[model samples]
Target: MGIKRTVLIDEPFPDLFCGLCQGEFWEIDFIPVLVPHFVFLLLLLLEILDDPVQVRCPEDHMFCSSCIGNYLQQSRTCPHCLTDLDPSLFQPSKFVQRQIGRLRVRCPYHEAGCTWQGILSDSHPNEDR
Candidate 1:
């Protein structure tokens, strides 16, 4: 087997390329142009996002319940913020509490030991009259 030698060619370098105005660009005479137009275009594209998005931690440092649950098994603390969020200690929000009460009703004659089952609206129809 014979070893083959390959020659690499450097692409032709521009000599007379105008930056601001067309002119010859010698090695030492060429100024690096930081085009603001491209950056402005990028900013314009970024601005096209209309809706706000919630931010979350990266995978390795995720602070969400699932991550914390997986990390500590049972102990619930945000991996990033260390905020305590125990599932066993979770309390129903006011909205949820209200909905629960709305969906349930006491006996019509609750004090008289009458135990009936119905929604609050049905149980309190007399109140509407």
Candidate 2:
């Protein structure tokens, strides 16, 4: 293998966000930190499951929620690791949550003619409120 290939593969994605950051993240800012995943849960639900669904395997790999959600419907075992799982085991990804929150998404009621486009947090209302 060429040195160039190794060098190129060593760097992380430029726009990678760790799901908890309220703003953009650079590759250098990556440091595993303890972040609460609750408040971000609602936001996770609203955001499209474009990123990997949070799985509780020994290895922390990402999976698209929709992909895993659908997969879970057919089999309780994780497709990637074949670990037995329950619906509750499939947590929403924190990184994906923050990434989605940063995205300007249409209101959930957009199809109902609500013209709203902004961060997911500001776009949706608290149903309990």
> Which numbered prediction scores highest in lDDT against the true structure?
2
99 Cα displacement, candidate 1 (Å): 0.4
lDDT of each: 0.26, 0.41
TM-scores for candidates 1 onward, in order: 0.19, 0.37
The TM-score obtained by model 1 is 0.19
Tens-digit lDDT string for candidate 2 (1-106)? 0001000112123222222212222212223434333222212122233554667876554455555665566787756567777667767666655654453344
Residue 60 shift from truth in candidate 2, angstroms: 2.7
List the RMSD of every prediction in angstroms. Answer: 32.5, 14.0
What C-alpha root-mean-square deviation, in Å, does candidate 1 show against the real structure?
32.5
lDDT of 1 by residue, 1-129 (tens): 000011101111221111112122222212343322211100111111111111132311212222223455754554335565444543223332232223333443444554544543253433332
What TM-score should be assigned to candidate 2? 0.37
Q: After superposition, how far is residue 59 of candidate 1 from its true place, in Å?
A: 16
